[model samples]
Target: MITLNHYLFVSGALFALGLAGVVVRRNIIIIFMCLEMMLSAANLALVGFSRFRVTDGLPDYAAQSLVFFTITVAAAEVAVGLAVIVALYRTRQSVEVDTITRMRG
Candidate 1:
């Protein structure tokens, strides 16, 4: 039988992987994906906790509602991040982090 600890461990592992990707990758697109991964990991943990915390044999709706809100936020973030990335790519012709590091005035 799966337990809350198991869910939490998986969530932690996914978050770590996402964090590593964000730190090590130079491309903005990859970094964006990693950020989404981190969000997903958080959502999973929330759902797991909500599922385990039974109230009269029913999972808590509050956590699930929060998860929905989080999903909405993540979706919005992706749309905005992609737009920014596209603009950067058009101006620089590259999506690498180094291209954006040095500012031109």
Candidate 2:
């Protein structure tokens, strides 16, 4: 049977992979995707803990509500982030992080 530990392990693995991607990849878009992956990992862990923890018969929705808020914020982040990426690409013609350092002007 799947348990909280299993969910936590999966979340941890996903977070680690996302971290690695963000650190190793040169493309801004991939880094943004990895950031989203990390967020998803956190959300999974939150939901798992909320589902497994005993609440003395009360309906525990705090974590779930937080997850919803997180999702909303992530959505907005993606919209704005992608727009910025597109603009950067239009100006630089490349998505590599190193190429953006000259944008000091």
Candidate 3:
């Protein structure tokens, strides 16, 4: 049977991986993907906690609602972020963060 700790552990591991990817990767797209992964990990943990702590098997609606909000925010972030990335790519011909430093005023 899956326990709360098990879910927490997996979520933590996934979040760590995402953080590593964001820190180590040079590409903007990959960094965005990593951020998404981290958000997903948080959502998983939230749902897991809600499910495991509640007496009823139906699970908590609050956590699920929060997850929906998180997903919406993530979607909006991706849309705006990807648009910026595309603009940067068009102007610089690359999506690498290092190449964008010259744009600093």
User: Relative to the true structure, how large is the alpha-carbon lDDT of every model?
Assistant: 0.93, 0.93, 0.92
Please give each candidate's TM-score: 0.94, 0.91, 0.91
State which candidate, 2 or 3, has the greater lDDT. 2
RMSD of 3: 1.6
Clashing pairs in 2: none
Q: How would you order the candidates by TM-score, starting with the best?
A: 1, 3, 2
Score candidate 2 by lDDT. 0.93
Q: Which ten residues in a row have the lowest lDDT in candidate 3?
A: 52-61
Residue 60, model 3: Cα distance from true site in angstroms:
1.5
Cand. 1 TM to true fold: 0.94
Clashing pairs in 3: none
